[model samples]
Each structure stands twice: as C-alpha cells, then as structure tokens.
Target: MKLRPGGFSADRVLRKFLPRSLLGRSLLIVLVPLVLLQGVALLLFYGNHLNELSRRLAGGVAGEAGFMIDEIDRAPDMRSLIIQETDRYFQFTTVFLPNQVLRHLPPPDAPGPVDDDLARALGQEMHRPFNVAWNTAPDFIRINVQMVDGVLSIDVPRKRLYIGTFYLFLIWLIGTAGLLFGISALFLRTQVRGITRLATAAEAFGMGRDPGPIKPEGAIEVRRAATAFNRMQERLRRFLAQRTIMLAGVSHDLRTPLTRLRLSLAMLPEVEPGEMAEMTGDIAEMEQLIATYLSFARGEGSEQAVPTDVAMLLEDVAAAARRAGATIEIGAPEGLTATLRPEAMRRVLTNLIDNARRHAAHVWLSAAIHGRTLRVSIEDDGPGIPTSQRETVFRPFEAASPGGTGLGLAIARDIVGAHGGDIFLFDRPGGGLRVVIELPA
Candidate 1:
C-alpha cells in the first residue's frame, strides 16, 4: 500500500471511516439521499411557505393596530370606546398608562422568523415608536406604541402568526426517513447474506472441504453468482473423477509391460545371478516409478476434509516410518487437532520422511500450532539443497537427491496446496535440510 504524509495510507484512512460490510454500505447508499432530501424539503417549506405566511399574518396584525391608533388620534374623546371595540373584535387585551413617555428600545431577541417579520410589519404600518415583547406570555405577544396622550399597550394572540404546520411536516419527514432507513437496512442484509454464504462456500471448497451446493437467493446478480459457484464445484469434481479414471487406465497399461519384463527376467536360463538381480531391480524400479507418477498426477481427489488429531496423526506417520526401518523422532503436544484430509496428509508426511531417510540416517518430525496456523517440519542431517536450487527442487523430475523421481516433493506440495497450505525447504540449524509445511489451523 502507498502511504500519505505521517505514514498513513489514504486507503487505510478511508477504510477506517467506511463501513467494512456490504450491508452497511448499501444502507448508506439509501440513507444519504433520504437525509439530503429531507433537509432540502425542510429548507424549501420553512423558508418559502411558512415564512411568507407568517409575514402576511404579521402585516394584518400591524394594520389593525395602526387603525386603532388612527381612530384614537382622530377622536381622543372616544379612545376608550375604540379600545373596547378593538379588544372585543380581535380577541386582544388593551391597556393605557397615562402620561407615560416611550423610549427607544432595541429589538428583542427573536425565537424564530415571526418576531423579526412582525417588527418589520409594525414599523411599516404603525409609523411610530413601538416595542414588541415576545416572551412575556406563552400564547400572546405584547406590542406597545407611543400615542400623543400616553402609551397604548396591546397583546395579540400568537396563534394568528403561526399555523403550526411546520411541526407536523417535520414529524412526518423524520418518521418517513426512519421508516425508509429501517426498510433499506433489512433489505440490504438479505442481499449481503447471500454473498457471505457464497464466499464461505468458496473458502471451504478451496480448503479441500465439501460445503455442498448453496441455494441461489437474493438479487439477480447474487443468485447468478451462487449458481455459478455450484456449477464450478460440480465441474471440478467431474474433472478430478475423469482424471483419476484415465490415470488408472494408463497405470495399468504401463504396468503390464513391466510385469512381462519381470517374468521374462525370472524365466531366463543360464543367466548370471548378479545380472539377473540387476535386471530384476531395474524392472522393479520402473514399476515403482510408474506408481509414483500415477500418485503424483492423481493428487488428492474427492477427499473431504475433517478434523483430525494432528498430534496423533504425526505419531502414526512417525511410527510407520520406524516400522519401515527408518529412525524417526517427534515433538508434538497432546490434542493438537486441525482440519485436513488425513490420508492425503499422511502421504505428504510419508514422502518427506522417506526422502529425508534416503540421504540421512536420522529424521525428525514435529508438529506445532502458531496462532491460526499449523506447522509441521521434517528435518534431517542430509546435505541440504543449495540456495539457488531450493525452489527448483520442487518442480517435477527435478530431484533434490540421487535416484529420486523428483515427484515426491512435487506431490507433497500439490497435496499441501490443496489443503490451502504451503511447503518450504530451508537449511537446518545443524547444517542439514529442513522441509516445513504450514497450514491453516
């Protein structure tokens, strides 16, 4: 990965903030637009619709107050009657304080656009010194105006300026956004679950375990991927079966000639015992070579993985090698279990041990677990392979030692790869060769 300044990778930073799962990302895809739409809707409705309506209402109230002022100025004697009529008709309360002088007051702090709009409307209509009190009462706004005689105070009902439609609209907007988000989350989870199952099946199959076929589900693309995975599994299984059959036929045909040669060598008359023995050994070697080729080409076919006690498996392979007259030593803990194809794994260990014993008297076999990985080593005192040729030794027909078919390590590597593991060769600490196998625990 490339790093940005301060040793932080740009992709790493993005991953830290980004949702790691498909379901979360898919829900974000739905929710981001929903939230943006809600914001735009609120801005348009409150800014245009609610604002204009509140301004008009404020103007109407300001007009009524101006008319009251005009009537009082026209006939000061009927001021009491005008106040009574205005209070009765407009659902307002009026009071007069005699000989009171009005002072210039800065506009009060406004709770919303209504207060600012109302003050502007009042200035336009009343055309005199005035003050608007917003929080003196919960349901009423107080407006005091300067008159020739004294100050006239009026309380206007707040409901006239506010229809309260915005609150209802806000509630609907939030409720719908939440409902849509919930639906999106639920839908995305189902789609993501199908992909998760497909990935899990693929991993299991890669590890040489049978996960069977998964049912195609969810969206079209997801269902098609599942179907394709199932088909791939079937095709691979058929291909392995066909290869095994063909290999078996080839091995039989090759062995028939070797069998006839062995019989002919046994039936030869007046032949030197040593020559006959040499011929017999050559024929036997050819037969063994054919068997080894077949084993290598067949690989690990149709072997379902299962949990095996690896400690016990190692002990078994070691004991078998000892029975075959090869000295073996082991180091493993009790109950060291791992998922593997036991027979295939045994073949791999046997090949490595046999190879080591061919060139060295003593062989060491050990198994251990490291984190989520299982590691096995076959070490010997044989002359280790050269550094340059270590990798080349794994290729077929490139034997690491004399008289080796070179298929032993190749077959071992094939089986280990099938188990989603790897085999490596290295120089041993005591000046010998060490072959290590690492697998998922």
Candidate 2:
C-alpha cells in the first residue's frame, strides 16, 4: 500500500506517545480504564463518606468540651471539682486561669480536613470567641476559650478526631488494583509471544530459508493466520517445482532438433554463403533465447545459505570485469559478511555489472551499512532509464536495450528477493542509471 508523505509523519508523531509493540499496547488497553475507575471510586469515597465521618467525629469532641465549659461556669467555686471529674471520665484535661486572658492565634500552614471540621463544630457550640491550635504539640489539640475574667484551656488527644477505617479502605483499593494489573500483564504476554513466533517463521520462509514446522497457538484469529501462511508456503513451493521440471524438459527437446539442423547445414556442399550465414545467425539467436529462459526458470539452483565475505565477492567480480576490458571501480569495507546463497548472489552482481558496462565506459560500485541493512549501489554513465519504464523493465522479456533477452534485471531481482532484499533503480548523479540493492545484515 502507498502512503501519503504527511500520513507517515503523522503516524510517527502518534507513535511517540503510544506504545510501539503489541504487548505494550494491549496492556494499555487493559490498564487505562481500570486506573480511571479506581480514581473515580477514590474521589467519591473522599467527597461523601470520609468527609461526613470527619465532621461527626469533630462535632463529638466539640460537644464534650462545651459540656465541660458550662459545668465550670455554673459552679465557679467547684472549678477544680469539674476538672477532676472530666479528666477521670472523658480523657480531657481542663485548667482554669484566674488572672491571665488568652489571645487568638493564626491557623497552621498545613491544616488537615479534621482541623477545618473541628473549627466549624467548635464555632457553633461555644458562645464566646476561642482559639484552636492543632500544632501546639504533636500528640494533642489545644482549645482556649475566653472568659469574662480569665480563660479555659482544654487539651484533647489527636486520635479523637481521626477515623482508622479511612486508611484501611485506601490500602485495600491500591493493593487490589496492583494485583489485578500484574495478572493481566502475564496473560497478555503469553498471547503476544505466539504472534512473535509466527512473524519470525514467516520472515525466514520469505528469505528462502527453511522454517521448521509451525504449530498454531494463541487466540483463534492468530491461529487462523498461521494456518493461512503455511498453506501459501506449500502452494508456492509446489508451483516453482513444477515450472522448473517443465522448462527442463522443453529445453532438452528443443536442443536436439537444433543440433541436427546445424550439422545438416555444415555438411551441405556449395551452399550460398549469404543465405547460410543468415540461417546460422537465426539458429544462434534461438539457442541464446532458450538458454536465457532455462537459466531464469531454474532460479540459480537450490543452494543453501552460508556466511560469505561480501567485499571479497565484489573484488572477484571487479577483477573478472577488468579482464574482459570493462573499467569497473569497487568501493567496499573490509570483512563485511552476510548469510547468502553465494552463487546466486554472484550471478546477480555480475548481471548488473555487465548491463552497466554495456552502456557506460566507466562503472562505479559502492557499499555501505545503514542500521541493520547493507546497501550496495552500482552506477553507470550511460543514458538513464525514464522513471515511467523503470518498473516495467523488470518484467521478463521486456528489454530497455535492443538485441537484449531482457532477463538480466528480472533474474537479478528474483534472486535478491529470495534473499529478503530489494533492488531499486534511479537516475545516476551525473547522467546514467543507478541500481541500489538493500539487504538485511
């Protein structure tokens, strides 16, 4: 499929924020909604349930303090008696100051929900103005109520205004979500692993390498895809085998009659030289056409892939071309090795170089490594192919040049494609054709 230029750039931008792999994307699909649900639940619990509970707890503490203040005011002579009784029963300590008055102080910088609730509750219950200090000490809350001539100081323990159940609810919510996400990740990874194996097998088969038996696994859809791939692989192999056999038989049968005709022409006495030359030339062209067809049909034979030094192979091709009176320049790095069918790859390179030599006086060959791919370019100084005809020239029997069988580029492309590589044609920098071959390292 062809993509618009802007489509590719937009996809890249989207990928920057999205996960790149199937497993990660699947995990995101599962976890995002779960996190949002948990967030909403926590918000509701804090807004309604936790807030109401804090207010009630604060009100209870304020009620106890108000009762103590009223008892001390009604019987000022028994202030010590009221203090002793309240301390014994309610866990509060109250002191009566006769001469000094207490001033109101500012609230703390970091006040808790309990502090706000307590302030409101105390404001409604007490008739006189008061000051509430939450940070007077770490373990207690202090409330000072102004009296006509003195002040009433009350100290209450911090635990009286807090609900222990709030913390328990939070722990349960977070711990359960973590456990659920972990389980989901484990399940997702197992399913994704099957797809990974299937992709690897498909790639190896495309490169003409043996991919051992593929067993179906994962979800039903993934299994279906694997089954389809296996069937396609078998059908392609059978078709190629049948074609090769048919071509071999045809080539053998045609050559026998052509050989007898050549012998008959040679034995004829006083044959017209011009007519005889023409007949022989036609016979020679027929033979050359048959040979080219046979070569393309056989697909360079069934050769196993092995590690080969690409630089040395190029050097040998250049040396051979030079001996044939072709000026060829090769630029490649040392010790560049790749797994390949050496004979087939050599044929591909030789065909490209020969085609270049036929049109240009000087040919240039260069290689470079880009990421995980090795790129090799062959350039010539001849007239470059027009963009419209570049793809058409790769078809069998479709030649760009006169008197050519037109199978050179087609055969080269087939061989390169079998090795999971691609060949592209472009205009040379100065004025000719440039062919680029890209192979995975």
Candidate 3:
C-alpha cells in the first residue's frame, strides 16, 4: 500500500495521463479498441498466413536451382543445355560464368522474413559456396552458386516470394479502421456538445445569471440529461415565482393596517403635538422595518441579468449617502460594466454605503474592473467590526449595533452571492472598515 510514500499512486498516474475533456476521452475510448483489433488481425495474417506462404515459395525456387546443378554435375558437357532447359521451364534467367572464382563475400544484410527463409532453404538444398542478391533488382533475386568449373547465376522473379493480396488486405484494414474512427468522432462530438451546453447552463444558473432552456440534441441519454436540466431550471423559476407572489401578498396585507393607523393619527385633532410626532415616528419606523424584512426574504426578486455601468451605480449610491447628511468621497472610472441584476446590485450598494455612513465620520466609495471581475469597495472611518465578528455580522438578525436589524449585511451578501460574486470585510489601513464586493465582469 505504501510502496513509495507520497510519491505516486496507480490511480493518480492513470488520471494524470488520461484525456480531460469528454470529447477527447470519448475518441480515445473508440480508438484504443480499434487499434487493438487491427493489431491482432495484422499479427494473425503475417504470422500464420504470409510467413508460411513466403517459406513455401522460397523452398520451391531453391529446389529448382538444386536440380539444375545436379544435372550439370552428372554430364559436364551438357551444362549449357541444362541452364537453358531450366530457364525455359522455371522462367528464370540463367548463365554460367566460367573461370571466375567466387571469393569470400560479406554476410547477408537483406530485410524481411522472406529473404531469411529463402536463404535457409537454399543452404539446405545445395551444399556449396553461394551468394543471394535480394535487393540488386526490384523484380528479381540474383542467386550465385559456385560450381566445380565456374559459377551458376540464376535470376529468380521477386513475385515468387511475395503475394499482392497481402498489401491489399493491409490497405483495406487501415482504410476501414480510419473510416470507422472518423464516423465515431463525428457522432461523439455532437453528443459531447449537448453535455457541454447543459453544463454551461447549469453554471450560469448557479451564478444567478439566467441561461434559458438549452436545445436537447445528441444521443438518447445525452438528450435525456439535457431535458432534465431544462426541467430543473423551470421548476426553480416556478418555485421562486410562487414564493414572490405569496410574499407580495403578505407585504400588502401588513402595510394596509399600518397605512390605516397613519391616516387615523393624521386626523386626530385633539392629540398633543409632541405625542403625535412620536406616534408618527414609531409608525414610519415600523413600516420601514416591514419593508426591510420583506426585501431580505425576497432577495432581489427574479431580476434578469444585464450589463450595467457599475461606476455610475456607485456614484448614485454615494450621492444618496450625501443627501442623507453623510460626507462621502468617490472614485470610479467611466464605463466600468458588469453583468448583474441592476436593482439587486443597487440594494447591495445602498446597504453597504448606508452602513458605512451610520457610524463613520466619512465614507469612501470606489469601483474598478480587475481582469474579469468588478471590484467595488466601501471604506469608512467608522469602528471596524472585530475580525472574529466580521463573518458573524453577515448572519441574519446578528445585529452589530444596538437597534440595528442586522439584515443589511446579510441581504448585501445574499445579493452579491447571487451575482456569482463575493463580499469581503477587512480593516482599513488607518482605522476603519473596508467592505469589498467582487462581481464577475
């Protein structure tokens, strides 16, 4: 189990070498088997069929050469006649080179099992000094055998040792394998495309960006998977819709009584001025509380994603903070755009800026595009939350200050998360809170 501690495991090594994409792995799946089948077929043909066929052909030629030699040795005067007779019968080009001593020659360096088989057959048939030139000519093999008086040269046609059908068979195997591989790759790519689209849609949906129903295509299983993803998207949208309608009704019903209470208080002619002021203030606060709670529950409603000028949006929030009697400094470039729900992002910016304004002497707002992310930061001179409490402050109802609903940071984080972004809390360099929201661009 621990052959080499922390080195490499068989599974890990295999995974590292394997193709990562569905299409690559799919093609490999088809390819590996096709190659193996072809290899086995080639081996069977070469080992059993072609190898034996070459040896048998080589044997026949060697036998004919031996017969001609024997005839010449028996009747030395009929040597010329024997060469002519053998050439006519065996379709060989034959000649006798007289008084030419065949000397020591280099070893055979020819390739293929055919030449080796032929050489072995020749050695067995005729026991004499001999040399075979396999590659001197394309259509012929030159065999030189040393005779008592001279050397016998026989040119055997190369066709005797080779068959044309083997080459054709090889071409057919390769061509068919390539054809099948191409067809499989074509169909596999279409199926992989369906899965890829489905995966993309899922990612966008999870990021709170809407990707409408993807087209169902490809094989039956892939199509079924695509259909399921589309159905899941529909179900989620329907559920959110139903919850929104129900929450809207609840908001209306709760506000109706408060509206009546405000109207009644306004008409009370005998009420003391100071007491009326307090009652009106309390009523307004209650209404505000109701709206905040409803907003937290609704979580920015089903707003479709669109490209918005986030720099302009930050300026608007800063202006609102100024109107609310807070001094604010702003720095953001023009045309800093990102895809997000404008209204939902508005609530996030408003909540963060307002939170900074409440306790800080001054507020700073800035927006910048960082690579593919839109980074918006709100810094203030207010006392920063403890590092330990920074994460806790985002939890619903976990108010950081007295009388604070604690839903502001929670709602802000929810909205940012829905946009496939994040909110981070950090200590400002001097002495304050630094709130940064990063959204995908």
In the range 1-441, model 3's lDDT, one tens digit per residue, is: 566876878988989999999999999999999999999999999998988988999999999999988888899998888889899999899988988767655665554578889989999989998988876688898899998888888999988877888889899999999999999999999889998998888878977888899999988998999999989999999999999999999999999999999999999989999999999999999999899999999987599888888788887877887899989998998888888889898899889888888889898989898888889999999888889998898999989788789999999999988888999999999999999999888
User: Distance from true position, residue 84, model 1, in Å?
Assistant: 7.4
Per-residue error for 8 in candidate 3, Å, reads 0.6
- Candidate 1 residue lDDT tens string, 1-441: 656577867677888998888888888789889999999999999899988988999899998998898999899999999999999988889999888977666666655588888988999988898998777788888899988778999999989888778789989999999999998888888989999999999988998998999999999999999999999999998999999889989998999989999988788898999999898999989989999988988887778899999999999999999999999999999999999999999999999999888888899999999999999999999888889998887899988567889998899999999999999899999878999999999
Give the count of colliding residue pairs in each prediction: 0, 0, 0
Tens digit of per-residue lDDT, candidate 2, span 1-441 = 788766767668878999989999999999999889888998888889988988998999999888888887899888888989997787887777777677768865433478788888999888888888778888888889887778888888878887777788789889988999999999999889889989999898778776766888888988898888888878877887788788889999999999999999999998999989998998999998888888898886467678889999999988988998899898999998887788888889988998999999999998877899878899999998899999998999988789898999999999999889999999998899999999887
Ranking by TM-score: 2, 3, 1
Looking at model 3, residue 296 earns an lDDT score of 98
| Cα RMSD for candidates in order | 5.1, 4.4, 3.9
Which candidate would rank higher by lDDT, 1 or 2? 1
| 205: Cα error in model 3, Å | 2.9
TM-score of each: 0.74, 0.83, 0.81
In candidate 1, which residue ranges exceed 4 Å CA deviation? 1-16, 54-162, 186-194, 219-225, 256-280, 325-333, 357-372, 377-383, 425-436
State residue 262's C-alpha deviation in candidate 3, in Å. 4.3
